[model samples]
Target: MTEPASARRITGAGIVLVFVYGVMALAATGRSFVQIVREFDDAPLAYGLSAAAAVVYILATLALMFSRSRAWYRIAWIAVIFELVGVLVVGTLSIVLPELFQHPTVWSLYGSGYVWIPLVLPFCGIWWLRTHRPAAVPELAAAAR
Candidate 1:
């Protein structure tokens, strides 16, 4: 059977988005694991932030992958927006108060460590979520009316 228009949209370019998020999740997880295990004392704040970034990436990837559901779509929005905010806050803090973050994280220096992909990915995610939102189910729409 053929998929509906909404499903196709959700799984179309979204596939690429999912792929990128998946890669980010893996990279962040690996980086954070090494940093935290190797030298938590060297820069607890920076390594902790890296671990948090990994969790956010993992959540975003899962939310996007399961975005066919309305709840998951909203979760995707939350995750992506949170990621953008995190990158901005962490990036600024790392620069303005370098002492606080003795070590660089995935989001440090505006993601300079990762070629700024961390800074740019959230914008792309937000755009994709807005463009490919799943259509409301008729039952839900009727209930809301």
Candidate 2:
């Protein structure tokens, strides 16, 4: 039997998210690597934070891309939440304590380098997941049957 439209829609949204996150992952990784290579000793704390954020973005992208289970969805949600918190905290700190961050991270300056998309993407992701709850899939399939 064919999959229901709702299932397809949800999966499609997930695919779109995968693409977006993939781009973010690349940006974060590249920027972090560049900073670390250029001057790791200058601001080790900020550089390390950037690297950690890159890792999280990469993992979240992969999870969303290959996830077939609800557990994976949950993991993605958690990762996205962490990403949001990291951006907010780091952004605020960068503003409030400019001296602390001699270097920038993906979350630095409220993701200003990325046009604040990083700050907003997680909220979008959470909303998409909530609206596309997997529970709707069984209902859709049953109706189709």
Candidate 2 regions with alpha-carbon error over 4 angstroms: 1-6, 9-13, 135-145
Clashing pairs in 2: none
Q: What is the per-residue lDDT of model 1 for residues 63-139, given as tens digits with 9 covering 90 to 100?
A: 99888789999999999999999999999998999898778899999899888999999999999998878888999
TM-scores, one per candidate: 0.92, 0.83
- Model 2, residue 62: distance off in Å is 1.7
Off by over 4 Å in 1: 1-6, 9-12
Task: Give per-residue lDDT, candidate 2, residue 64.
Answer: 70
Model 2, 93-129: lDDT tens digits are 9999999897888899989989998898888778776
Candidate 2 is scored at a TM of 0.83
lDDT of each: 0.91, 0.83
